[model samples]
Structures are given as structure tokens and as C-alpha cells.
Target: PLGMESGAIPDDSITASSYWAIDHESYRGRLNGVGGVGAWAARTNNFDQWLQVFLGMVNHVTGTIIQGRHHHNDQWVTSYKLQYSIDGISWKTYTGNNGSEKVFPGNNDRSTPVTNLLVNHIDARYVRFLPQSWHNWMSMRVEILGCTMNSKFLLKA
Candidate 1:
């Protein structure tokens, strides 16, 4: 849950792109514990166009769920790379054994969401959904599933 009222969405993206079919706030549905009607949209059909959601603190992210626009499939992401960063500017792609950034494929059915479970735990503050390829434009509703930094490790230090 990264985009809910408890979290923050970068304002630079809110009004920066014309491709938004709905407001960016809608991407936080899973954060609110309820699904929302709106989805975040991008202005271009380009690679690497993305949105970032801040959890307000560091977390041990375990997995992620991405739902395409519920009403239709026109602008759904067809493939993407999930990236996380402890500091907003420094990002590391969640990788596979091949050492390349793992590309998670999306569903053609708009209503069915896609998921990515990280190969290893990621201690991060920001997460980004970077589109590799899309049907037309990039749009999604997201849920970042994880928990707060484990205190047991801190105590050990």
C-alpha cells in the first residue's frame, strides 16, 4: 500500500502528462484496502515512463500486484520491470538468475491483475513500475505488498 492517504505521490507527475485518463490518486486503491474506480495513466507509449509511490518510511517489500484499467484493456501495460530504491534517485531492478532486470508480463485481460514476487527481500522506501511494453499507453492500479523493516535485525546490530 503505497499511494493511499497514508502515503505520498510525487506531484511532478500529476499534471505533467496529458496521457492521464484518470487522476494519479486512483493508483492507491490497494493501499486504502478497497479497490478504486480510477487508475494512473501515462502520456506516452515509450519505454521507462513510470510513477513512484513513497511509503513514507523504509519497508521490506515482498511482492507487488498491478491491475490494469478495470473498465477496458486499451492502455494496459503488457510488460514491465519492477524497481525499488532506498533513496529515491538510486534504483535497482528486481533481478532474476540471469542477472538482467526481470520483466514481468501483464495480462491481456484488463480485469485480471498481475503479480511479481521479489526473488529476495528488498529494503526500500520507493517503488516504481517501469513499463517495458504496453498495449497503447501505460495505465495501472497498484498494490505493493510488504511490511515495515523488521526490528529484530536492527536489535541484532
Candidate 2:
């Protein structure tokens, strides 16, 4: 997650609303979810400021994915993404940045696994992620490794 706005932040209490402490060593491995889910964070100062979220309804029998370690640029990672949504407000095929992950300098991206996520019938509530921009403020750590599924089991990738 990344943030800066409050008038584009000069330290006006850090804008965009200002909330901190979410870089819990960044999310690395093991994830699962279900319907009506949503994620799109905003935190950090700059070097740690990165964001481009789009998360919602990760359903597919209680959606959960994190197969075999994904995310790089090491150093506790500073960029990350994983997007999906059916009607959370127009969004599809995007695991990270512009869709089709493998980001750098914090551009995050993901998607395209037969529409990345949001099962077949399209009812995805909302799910988003594009955190850690990494500028300097220091605060981003995105990583993943495991997840199975849950939330009504609509298995049909």
C-alpha cells in the first residue's frame, strides 16, 4: 500500500486520509478469500509509497491463491498487485499492474488466468491490490506463497 495526498503531502498530516502500519513485513504467501471481498491499500511516504489497487469478491469456492512464492525485487518488496472484480466497478484480468504481473520500481500487475479471478457467473463484489511504490518513506513488503479456497465453492476457474 502507498499514500500521499493531503494536498500532495508536504506533511499536512499526510493526505489521502493518513493511516499507517500495514507493512507487516508485507504480505508474503498463504492467502484465501470469498465473495464480497475488497482490497486496495494506501500507505507509505514515497520510497515506500506505492498503490494501484482493485480488489473484490474473490470467490471460487472461497477464493485463495498463493501457489509457490511470487513477488520480487526482494528487500522486503516494495511493489505488489493482485486485482479482480466482476461488478465492484468494472475490472478484469489483472494480477498486478496493467494486468499480467511481474512489476518493478513499484508498478505492480496481475491477471489473465481465464480472466484471472472472480469465478464464472461474474458477481465479484470487489478485490484490489497495488501496494508499495517504494520511494523513500520506507513501508512496503508484498509476498505470497499459499492459499486454497473457500466461500461457497464455485470451482470452475
Candidate 3:
């Protein structure tokens, strides 16, 4: 399943701080991968704003791709924290100096998206994208990687 089409978005999937509106809709589908040019936008410029997606089921997440909003101009995420939660209540941050709250650097080139390869697998059902800094505005087209829980179970070696 590519995008959010395969996974399920629970009612709690969209608890962001705020949203930005324009010719485009500030919908979550923008992150669903179905939208080749679709994207999700945050209203506030503050770092507290975030977007979280539920994978419907647990998965062994390995990596991710973050595509900036490039309808005409560039809207890229500069710095952010990637977090995962198994139960959706408690969360753990990835990519940081302390190794707890990891801050991942975004794409410097607007024309292309950035791929982040994790050193280890994250087993969780919810993945959250929290923007700490950005170039233009906080907007993104996202792709989650790795396999389903069943695959994790069957492929146990």
C-alpha cells in the first residue's frame, strides 16, 4: 500500500496545532502519497505544530521520505523531529544528539524530496512529523517505509 490508501487514518490522526488555507486544501491526504502534488500545511509558524499519521496496523518502519510543497515555489521543512508511538499515547523521538529527540535536516534542494534512512527499525503504529524549523512554510508530502506487522512476524529470523 502506497500512501495512506493502504493504512487507516483513525479519528485521532489529525490533532495538529493549526492549519494554513489557500488555493489548496489543508487536508491530511496531502501526506497520503496519492497526491503527486498534494501536501499538508500548518497554520502557525511555531515549532509546536505537528502532523501525525496512523498506519492502521503496527509496522516495522525503516525509513521515510519527506517531499516539500512545490506547486510553483518551494515550501520545505528545514529541521524536524521524527517520532513513533506503539500505542499512540506515549511517543519516542528519533534523530538527535542525545539520541532521544533526533532532529533531521530537510532537503536543501526544493526541486527534490529528501530520504531519511534509519539505522534501526521502529515498531509502531503511529508516526509523527513535527516541524522545528522551515524554509518557507511548514508543508509536506510524506511516504512511510517498511513492512506490515504480519510480515515482521513471518519474516522473523
Candidate 4:
């Protein structure tokens, strides 16, 4: 795991388009964060809302694990799309083997985590989860699944 729950990924690396409030802040969007409201909630519930993470360096991202707002079954992301970037400027959406954009299914409830593995691994330093559909409102906690690229491989890429 890239460590949203384990804190291997620092708080500075986690961010979102907008947060509901301090308690529902972006940094709290880590799997099983402080407990209640242990997820990031957007200021507005819409398709445009997003939660992002900076991996610090390029990693072979294989999948993602997601959950909804803690203890609140009504508030959770139902579906989302992933976009990745190497420099945080130019981005490319994760696609299927046929090259169409992929929409990953999100949680059905608040606590049970949902996992989505990529068909092709993405080598990127940044990954953003853009909500496509949600339950009550846009809210989620997430963790990236992958390993850091070897230093030599990173330099070559």
C-alpha cells in the first residue's frame, strides 16, 4: 500500500478540489482516519469534485482501495475515474485495454473498503480520484496500491 492509512504518505501529499470543513479536510481522506467523518468531503456534491495524492516519486501504481465517510452509510462515493500525472500538470486518465476511460466502482457503504486494480500499471507521481457518481454527497477515504520505482528505473524513464 502507498500508505494513506499507514501515514507513509504525508498529509501534505493529500489534497482535494475543495473540502467541506476542517473536520472533513482533505488530509483526513485516509482509510480509517480519526474515526467518525474519517473521510474527505467536497464543499459541493458534484462530478467535478476530486481527491488527489502525490506519491513523492514515480511509482508503478497497480490499484486503489477506497472507502466512504466513516460511520455514515449515506455519504460515500459510488463511482470515480482516475487521472495520473508525472509532473502534476499534464494528466492522463486511466483507461481500459481498449483505450476507453475507466470508471472504478466505489464503496456501497461507509466502512467496508472497495478495491479496484488497474488493467495496466501507471507510472506516475500524482493520482487524482474524480468522483463520477456518489451517494448522499461526495466523500471518500483512499489508499494507493503500488511500489516505488527503482531509482535507476526512474532515472531511465
Candidate 5:
């Protein structure tokens, strides 16, 4: 786990285009937090909204786990696309084997976790989630899957 669910990832590393309120702030977007309502909720439901995470260093991102607001059952992402960056300036969208931008399916209801394994793992320091379709409003709690590079590997790179 990348540590959002466990609070290992700091609040500074989590951000979003906009949040509904303080309680639904980006930093609250941790799986199982606040009885599951601690998800990041956009101020408005739109295609431009995004949730982002900075890993502090590059990591091999293999997959993602997402969930919606637990108690509400009304707000949740149904689908989304991923973009990753090494320097936070230039970004590349994750693509399918066909070389098209890949859209990952999100949760159907609140609380239940949905996991999606990447067909091509990404090595990145920053990752953003762009919601495509939603149940009512765009909201989500997420955790990234990957392993950190060992000292030897880091030195070689």
C-alpha cells in the first residue's frame, strides 16, 4: 500500500482541484477514514476535477484501489483515468495495450473497495486521478499499490 489508508502518506502529498468542504478535503481521501466518508469530494461535479498524490520519489506503481463515501451511498466515482509525472510538470496518461488512454472502472456504491491492476506499470513520483463518470457527485478514497526502490537500485538509477 502507498499508505493513504494507513496515514503513512502525508497530507501535503494529497491534493485536488477542489473540495466540497474541510471535512471532504483532499487529505481526508484515505480508505476507511472517517467511517469511509473521509473521501475527497469535488466542489462541483465536472470533468476538470482531479485528485492527485505526490509520492515524494519515483515508485513502480502497479495498481490502485478506490472506494466511495461510506455512509452517503450517493457520491462515488464510476470511472476515471490516470496521469503520472516524474517532475510534476510533464505528465503521461496511462494507456491501454491498444495505445489509447485507459479508463479504469471505479466503485459502484459507497464503502466497497474496487481494485484495478495496471496493464503497464508506471514509474512516477506524482499521480492524478481524473474522474469520468460518477454516481451523483465525484468523490473517492484511494490507495496506490507499489514497492519502493531499494538503496542499491536507487543508486544505480
Candidate 6:
């Protein structure tokens, strides 16, 4: 479901990706799941016509960066964590359960608006985020900030 309505996903002007094929190596370590209730994802997969529907949920305007450049960010999603992997099948490549280190301009507890989340140096094939909690926040135009580190390849390819 990706917590979004069908009307939300603007399949507008997307004409070049349906037939474009990616290299096998470019698809490594990509299918890893982030932190979330597996049951919820399962329900989404089952009822939502498989997870393929959610592929590329966000519109990439800049070099396929996969940013969720929304109107404003006021979602309850808090405490994001990041992890890495190399082999694609196993997540052996890991650092400390990094939050602030992986994220720039701060650590956890970002209760205020951070002007910039300086995160351009990160180059990984797999990355995951676990929204620990959310505050009293809800909006129609909330954004997910950057896309998964795994999504960067969409641009490079």
C-alpha cells in the first residue's frame, strides 16, 4: 500500500521505463526488506496485486534520484535507521546501527526541521529504514525524503 492512495501515484508521463531492461549485476542486493510488519506488507502484496504495483512509487525528476520532494514533511515517521549489504542474499556488510552517522546534519531526535539532510556521499546497493515512531503529525503532502540507497542505481543505469 505504501500508505498512499491510488490517486496519489501519478503515473503521468512515464513512457520510457516499461521496456527498459536493466543489467543483472545492477539488480544485486535490491530486494531486501526494510523494517516493517511483514504481515502488513504481505496483505499489501496479496490485495494490492503484488508488490510490483509499488515499484518506483515515487517520481524521479532529477537523474532518477528517487527523492520524495513533497510539499511539506510532517509525518509521524521518526527514528530512521540505516543498514547496508553487499552479497544481495546476505546482509553481512553492516556498520553500527547507524542513524545520525548515516544521516547528515544530525542524529536521531530530529524534532525540528533540518534545512538539509546532507546525504550525497552514501553509495550502497542496499539500504533500509525503520520508522521507530511518529509524533502527532499528519498531512496530505508528506514526503519520504530520499529514496532507498538501493534506488540510486535507477539513475546511474
| Index of the highest-lDDT prediction | 4
lDDT of 5: 0.88
**Model 6 TM:** 0.28
109-155 in candidate 5: lDDT tens per residue?
Answer: 88899999998899999999999999988989999998775435534
For model 2, residues 38-151, the per-residue Cα lDDT tens digits are 112234444333322212223332222221112321222244444446564575533333445533233222210111222222223333334434322322322221122343
* Pairs clashing within candidate 1: none
lDDT per residue as tens, model 6, 75-97:
22233333333433343222334
Q: Candidate 1 on 26-95: residue-level lDDT in tens?
A: 3433332233434666766677477566666798888887766655345577888887888788888889
User: In model 4, which regions exceed 4 Å deviation?
Assistant: 151-157
Clashing pairs in 4: none
Which regions of candidate 2 deviate over 4 angstroms?
1-18, 21-78, 86-100, 104-124, 138-157
TM-score of each model, paired residue for residue: 0.74, 0.22, 0.77, 0.92, 0.92, 0.28
Instruction: Give lDDT: candidate 3, residue 102.
Output: 71
Error of 3 at 106 (Å): 0.8
How does residue 153 of candidate 3 score in lDDT? 37
Each candidate: RMSD: 4.3, 15.5, 3.6, 3.4, 3.0, 14.0
What lDDT tens digits, residue by residue, belong to model 4 across residues 25-142? 8898998775547789999987778899999989999999999888544688999999999999999999999889999999888888999999899999999999999888898999
Error of 4 at 122 (Å): 0.3
Model 4: worst 10 consecutive residues (lDDT sum): 148-157
Model 3 residue 29 CA deviation in Å: 5.8
lDDT by residue (tens digit), candidate 3, 22-119:
53333443443434345667876787878777777788888777767756557777777888998989998875445576777776644466778778
Deviation in Å, model 6, residue 125 alpha carbon: 1.3
- Backbone clashes in candidate 5 total 0
